[model samples]
Target: MLQRVRLAVFLFVLGGFLPSVQADEVWEFVDADGVVHIGNAAPPASRGLVWLSQTPSARGGSGSAKGKEREVSALRLPGYEAAKPHLEAAALSQSLEPALVIAVAAAESAFNVEAVSRKGALGLMQVMPATAERYGVAGRILPDGKHAAMEPKVNAQIGSRYLADLLRMFDGDKELALAAYNAGEGAVLRYGRRIPPYPETQQYVDRVMRFYRALIR
Candidate 1:
């Protein structure tokens, strides 16, 4: 009877219906490239944490009786674990909290190293090309003036350093530094220390905070 109940609960989580029950459960995943991913939920497939198994399930998510999707939780990570070392390095070098770096990475691209914004923010940090080149990225641009941004380590290195610079500029105010990291330092200054009133900026702040809280809880 106990085993049957466990089996039934397992099916519920795979379908995206179970959100609340994932708390207190830490799932482990390893990618094809030998990256280790740990999550409260299964983490996202697109982020390349898919090949993980389950620890039994609770109620929630959709139900499919006979599929691989039936067992895994609704976890969807974007390859964050692979970059953890580099991200942590950059964070530590900058004297910033590594978790904050992870939070930003989670919000910015779910750890998709090659993520590019619709507005042409490039790389994992979503840096504009002009901004990227200014930071001593000596990789020359093509005739089209485009440079490679898929290098996750380089991207995180520069991004975190840039953020550290922002923190110093903002006088050690994390909120303001974070705001500048997202919407530009100018936006933070204009807002008078509050998150800027722009919808995108506000949403960015909220998302980072959510990830931060998730890590905390």
Candidate 2:
């Protein structure tokens, strides 16, 4: 009951800041005492934290499912358990929070190793073949003739590396980095490093942010 109350309060506070005039960053930290702390920025020397940033316009998006049901659905997603260790290892390699990587997987492909988007994004993180090639992760040509990014380990590694590169490119702004992930880094750069006004990109960032928050919470 107490946890629920706190989450409600957090949501209320979150909604309150969604209309701020400037891009806003929300930081979350859990101290050794296990209490969750949330603020616009992390205090000096903080540890065990995760955060997401976005322009106000990205709030209340619909690129993915909403509510507690989304979290429950993620846990029940096919291939979730199978992909967990790989996601963890990949995140560690990139010095990212495991929850963030897993959230991207959940938002992208629902942990479906066989999932492929119409745009040709593949595997757990929906990594494009071109993106995977940059990391030397060549998908196998399956017997059914699908270009299959079938290896969970390789796919996760490539996705994490790409996400890490975007994070660096966007100066650690998770929202803009995510926007790059969906709409291409070139598009983000064209938009002056802000979350592009594209609805799809905005919603994708919002969706991933929701999942990351739920996982960390």
Give the TM-scores of the predictions, in the order they appear.
0.61, 0.65
TM-score of 2: 0.65
Residue 54 shift from truth in candidate 2, angstroms: 20
lDDT of 1 by residue, 102-145 (tens): 77776565566665664566556666666667788756554555
lDDT of 1: 0.57
Candidates' C-alpha lDDT = 0.57, 0.66
Best by the lDDT measure: 2
Deviation from native of the Cα of residue 55 in model 2, angstroms: 19
Error of 1 at 114 (Å): 1.6
